[model samples]
Target chain A: MDEKVLLTGNIAAAEGALYAGCRHYFGYPITPQSDVVEYFSAKLPQMGGEFVQSESECTSINMLYGAAACGIRAMTSTSSPGFSLMQEGISHIAAAELPCVIMHVQRGGPGSGSTQTAQMDYNQVVKGGGHGEYRLIVLAPDSVQEIFDFVQLGFYLAEKYRNPALVLTDAIIGQMKEDVELRTIDFGPTPEDRSWALKIHRSPKGKSANVHSAVGIVGIYNEWLARTNEKYENIKRDEVRFQSMFMEDAELAIVAYGSSGRAAKGACKLAREEGLKVGVLRPITLWPFPQPQIEELASRVKKILVVEDNLGQMVEDVRGAVEGRAEVHFMGVFSRHMPDCNGMIFPDTILEEVKKLL
Target chain B: MSGEDERKLICDTPDCINNTLLPTCPGCLHGVVARCVCEAIDDLGIQENAIGVVGVGCHAMTAGAVEVDTISTAHGRAPGVATGIKRAYYGEAIVFTFQGDGDLGAIGLGDVLNAVNRGEKLTTIFFNNAGYGNTGGQMGPTTIEGQVTTTSPYGRDPAQSGFPLHMAEMMASLRGCAYSARVGINNLKNYAGARKAVKAAFQKQMDNIGYGFVEFLCTCPPGWKKKPDEAFHWMEKAMMEEYQLGEFKNVDEIT
Candidate 1:
């Protein structure tokens, strides 16, 4: 059995990446996610891996692009503003069809909103934050163990489809400590064909391999777009992951993810104790969001409460998924235990909203 | 004799370049610089192990002609990208960035400087065509004082628009930089010097010395509103006067 070690969300992510064979880590330090860079700096070099403390998030993401182009496992981690700086690079990486992992430990934001935990980056991560039509495989992990597990999963999916994968968490999980099992997951064999990657030696194809963002010719671009769209569709069809708790005979459902999902679990228990038939639907894959399940749940449940740490972002997706089949409500930053940047949404507070809804 | 035999080859194209690919502009020296880079790679016998990171602008077209495995990066971010490739290869592969004035001097200045400061084992080939040729003659960081570009219709004024950035000198000033030189391909004498400078820059990386930089003073005919020949003459007289051509720094080892 793999040994279980107490670890913070950030350390788990770093260890997860190392175990997944990610040898190159390029990142800039930002609040709520700096521990990731610190851990990699101290440990990666010792493991004969590369760690670059980039000047900014922009540089870091571009570096990730270059490393990924070489068909190697590489990643970077950042918070809100830093992630915003990475949008352009992400778009380019997506366009080039290179595989890489990015960990966004979300914080409060419109600008530099707060260093504390928040789910404000839901729209940016799920929807295409970068320019052009592109999608990231976004994973939201609620606990340190899940963070550890999902990071390895993120790398697997990224390489499997040759697309960027995002591990989306928040400051609460990033800073909190929990037991995490440290082990290398068997994601099957690595992709056999890497002819597309930049070669250390000349390719057997007798032509130089090139990776560029722009497909300048129109017809080629259309074909590339068709291929990319189909890939995204395949990802959507096969990669939707979520956890349904007490959903068997519930009339009301709580839709949440990441830290908010953890809080909702507690809320569901309290609601059950008070004789309310409430359940929690926690989405693990935020991009190929469990839309089908949400639509199915909307058919069964009369009301769905979308809980998030921000001012209603993922609720839009939930509402769209329900498509007016059921009434959708929202509980956000205002429902936090305290009314400040460091405030958290407690289970009791979520239960109060659950009671008010029913 | 057959037509092929009748036509004696005066000069052979480097094996690392696809000679069928043409330059983006009539008077642009990007093709010349590309050929020189290919020749350096061939001379170093590292064509298979060379990776070029190209930045956005007219210079980006050079990547299409060069045969080395290349990654076209966002504007001005080639240095950062090359740094990653070099580190990932663990100094086993040759890594270099091909960038333009606006890319290396203005938008990506911080990335370039930081990479150099980090003593990254990489090479940078900067094309200074005075203005942004791909964007239709907009003023750039390397545009000479009093140069009239589309953005500076009334000629660049040092008071309003700052002085032209001397990148070779700036790189030389950095402790991490091992080699820095500025050269031009306007004339045969300068063209020879430019080729040598390019080769030396790549050699610096091959020896794992430190950051190496070579700035090429190129011409943009349409951007400067000059005929091809006139542009060459103008570059020799005007551009050379503003930006002196020669090696600014060379070190046996970086301390």
Candidate 2:
């Protein structure tokens, strides 16, 4: 049997990062996500890694840039306001084309609304929060196991694309304890052998004279844009991941991601027992949108229900994917009235919505 | 060594220095400061292993000037970036940050102070040209009283813009800081001191001592709206008086 233990999403993320060969962790303490830093602070040193509790999110993200440029696996985590502060550094990281993982255990937003779970940062994370034209390979995880798994996958994708990747989870999954089987997956060869990485030499006379900057004269910037656009196109074509359940003969489809996806799965089961022909299409990668698969599901289903812990954020993506082939209804809930889990659209509520469509 | 060879050897400019004219305004002290720091790196023979973090400002364009590996970071976040590099590489990479007053003394104050406080073994060369140089002479945290700029057309009033910060003194007071100094780059005498300070900062990092800071009183003629030659004189007469030049603290003294 595999080694399994009850771990919170944050701890699983830390363990996953360690197993993924992350040697540096720079982070600022933030609510609902501070355990990631706490775990790394104690575990990293024992594992012969480095951990820094930075002064702010701005500093921590820049630290991520530095470590990533050295061709080392580095990571950081934060929540709403802290994530806002980190946008500038994230833009710099994207422009410089360095690979690193960033986690956002989302809370209520627009401002520091609350420390409870909320998915208001959907557009901010997937639509390039910083500046300029860029895209993060955003992986939305629904469970403690997915949190653990996505951490390693995030690093792999980050290194593979030479871009920053994010594990976008909300407070419910970040704090919830679940059984996770710890395992290691090999990511083949590291891409740091490229000429852009920093390394020690006897003199600055070799291929190691790397410069990691995004700003330059107009001509240089134009060239950079072309190159980055091409990389994003490849990611869109190759890196999209999602899971479909009971969609082959379903009359209704529920579109959800992250923790909302988990709830929608339960809702689907309840609807099935009640003999409603309902299913779920859970997107694991939010940025690429799983458009083709959603298009197929939309053709087969009579209606689509988009569920989220925020006010219709991912619903837009679902709509775009469905392309009006199916009638898409939004069951949007914001994390304002109660804690994240209670505030969310429960499985029973989702089952009721599915029955209505039926 | 022959006289010519000896002279050549004494010229410690690292090959990493972009031989092309610096992207800075003509007669700007940033060129001199860059040369001095590069020379220091060359002298220490850490050019191969050195990694620099270039802050966003006028210094952003200098990324290509150095042969060493460099990362151009967001404004005022170079110290944090360098801290990450040093932590990642630990003793293998000698990391440093080159930042200006606007980037360092103002926006980056908290990160730099905290990095120093945390005892990160790295080097920081702060270019204090008083006003924001690249941003068209805006007032900064280090803009001295009575110094006139676009933002301070009627002369800098301490009552309004507040006082200029003494970064070296503040850093030296921090427990994690191993070496802190304020140096001027106006003349040969002060220039020599600045060079030594830059070298010493790198040495401290290489020795795994702690955070080392050297604040240079750089001249920004365009920002000051003065001619280059006149700006040098102003830096000597006014800037020197307010920002005292010398090593504020040394690890040897502490030991």
i-RMSD per candidate, Å: 1.5, 1.7
Q: Kindly report the docking quality category of candidate 2.
A: medium
List ranges where model 1 is wrong by over 4 Å: A203-205, A217-219, B1-8
* Residue ranges of candidate 2 with Cα displaced over 4 Å: A190-192, A216-219, A334-342, B1-16, B253-255
User: lDDT tens string, model 2, B74-176?
Assistant: 7888888888888887768888888888898888889899999888888998888898888899998888898778889988898887899999999999988
Tens-digit lDDT track for model 1 on B1-255?
567767978899887887666657887788999988888888888888988899989888876777888888888999888987887888788998999999999999999999999999899999999989988989999899899999999999999989999999999999899999999887789888988898888888888899999999999999999999998888889999999999998887988
State the lDDT of candidate 1 residue by residue for A276-352, as single tens digits: 99999999999899999999999999999999998999999999999999999999999887889989999999898
List, in order, the clash count of every candidate structure: 0, 1
Query: Which candidate number has the best DockQ?
Result: 1
